[model samples]
Target chain A: MKRNPAALFFVAAVVAAMLFVGFHSARRAGSGNSDSLDVTGKPAPDFTLDSLDGKKIQLSSYKGQAVLLNFWATWCGPCKIEMPWFVDLQKEYGPQGLQIVGVAMDDASKDEIAKFVKEMGVNYTILLGKEAVGQEYGGVNVLPTTFFIDRDGKIVAREFGLQSRSLFVDNIKKSLSQGRAVQAQK
Target chain B: MQLMPRSKSQLAGVLLLFAASALAQSPGKKSPSVTLAPIDPVSVTRGKGAEVSLHFRVAAGFHINSNTPKSEFLIPTALKMDAPTDVALTKTSYPAGKDMTFPFAPDEPLNVYTGDFTISMMVRPLHTVQPGKYAVHGDLKYQACDNAACYPPKHLPVEFEVKVLKNATPAGRNPAQSPHAHR
Candidate 1:
């Protein structure tokens, strides 16, 4: 039997094509898992807003620490429900390089937010959220949307709507562990 | 080139694969913000008016903007109905909204409806219409919002049937039974 070089070349080309298509499809699937507002493993959008105490706070300033960026409002019932958990988490993890940043999307004045914070006994940094900033963060359509960012400012998880305290703690733990791993590598 | 035809076919195959994958990756349909309960059928006589109440319950932790929102950009809750030529929709009255004050702007108050609320619709059947069963189809347009953020506006469909009876006059009937008595 004569060896057909052309047939061998055709088989090799078909195999190469199939492998290329499989790799491309896998990459597309991986990227598609990320939400437009909360793209995991991507750099988080940075914004500067004034705190309830009249101090300017920049999201990027906490680059080396894990950040729990929560968008909430004073009137949101679920937000009220989750705020106490956030307060406890802040107290428990603040010393461990966890920075919780609360962005108030309220139509009320800053004084009202400050009063609410005082009433809730929130110890973390609370910043005023602007419509533009909300749009930048993928149009925070629900109250209490939270983003967990690692030490490198990359979003590790994006939670929409009200979540359980344990879910939040788990994501925070993951982000914090990733931060430590990166630090160890450095 | 000798390979031109083969390369062209290969390119076509790749494009077809890309189109199929793109379609598969499209987002799924979103669920409605408000759910409507099945309205009980109402009975009315020809040449008389009646009131029908449709109940709507918003999703938990969400409120639909009132008929009159504080800002123009905010979408106000509204109802529209489709009726036969013989049926006339007189008016629709939304329930009163609760005044809510948020921390973002304490001075500016927002009007919103939370939980379960009813919208009363006044419908009248023309005298020229014959007695029969008719279905009224309508939809409620509303933008659901929580204290922290607002969602895109959604439309919820509503439907109910009304049985029309032949108008009859009863002598010495009780005032409560008289259709014109209320009017």
Candidate 2:
């Protein structure tokens, strides 16, 4: 029996292509959950959590305003450094449709977080962060990770670790400008 | 019937292709997230002080915070050594960190270490100590972070053996060269 060399080569090439495609698709499917949440230009994941004052706050309620969502903990050193900056930004940009929300990813008691908030004079809304909510936001593993969302609830940028006050202000300005553009379009 | 040389060559070719693909898919092909490789140990005379160096590597795209954090509250990378009674740790020296600016903090520069770095320590033996082999344990504590997020603080344990020898000459005379001297 004679085997055609051309046929063997074609079969090998097809097998290689199929294997490559299968590997690529498997990798994508494995990371789909986190990728969908963290990808830029996608709508931010919405959740409802109780504020420090026992007010049920829905993320979608602030859709028309630019939002800065910060996931932090009381024990995190970087969180302490940026809490003051958040307070200042809330004061400066609140009138311009900026809403800074802090989700405390802490195991500390509510009184501890409240005391820290009072001491820092945080002017923004503070909510207790749940592990499930953190997972939904693609795992807030780092302390002081922040997401900048535009007025349309689309995440524009994500920041990790301790960020400078100027950087936060710059992001806020960008988000606010995006809000104006979105309003004009509506 | 016996197989022809061409048929044997074809089988060899197919095996070679499979081997290449398997090598490509192996996890060892990827760089490790973090690693601490122990360098050659140091030898010292009793009551004399000496230094030991260790190589530390952090994967690309990730950085560990520096010993001197930008803020007071941030967790700083620290190296702690557990020395035996005979072996005393005089001091530990850390290399200067690279100043990096990320998009999160474009203006303020943070001190961090990426890629490969070295941590060295000065150790001295007590005067009453005898010549022997001693194991020194150490822990490197750090918090790793990338552009997207930060991970919890991790403590990596490392150890290296030190061989202490008795002085051959008088107390004031020059000591002999170490046989295990690192290049």
Model 1 scores a TM of: 0.51
**CA error at residue A167 for candidate 2, angstroms:** 17
Taking the true A–B contacts (Cα pairs closer than 8 Å), what share appears in each candidate?
0.07, 0.15
Give the range where candidate 2 chain B is weakest over 10 consecutive residues by summed lDDT.
Answer: B23-32
Q: TM-scores for chain B, in order?
A: 0.75, 0.74
Clashing pairs in 1: A106-B104, A107-B104, A107-B105, A108-B103, A108-B104, A108-B105, A108-B106, A109-B106
Candidates' C-alpha lDDT: 0.75, 0.75
**How many residue pairs of model 1 clash at the backbone?**
8
Kindly give the stretch of ten consecutive residues in candidate 1 chain A with the minimal lDDT sum: A29-38
Q: Residue B173: error of model 2 in Å?
A: 6.5
* Candidate 1 regions with alpha-carbon error over 4 angstroms: A1-35, A180-186, B1-31, B34-117, B121-183
Q: What DockQ does candidate 1 have relative to the true complex?
A: 0.08
Please, what are the lDDT tens digits per residue for candidate 2 over residues A1-186? 667676578657755875675466445432101222454667888999989998999999998899999988764645766888888888889998899999998767788889878888998999988988888788766667788999988888777667678888889888877855576876
Could you say which candidate leads in TM-score? 2
User: Residue A121: error of model 2 in Å?
Assistant: 6.8
> Candidates' TM-scores?
0.51, 0.55
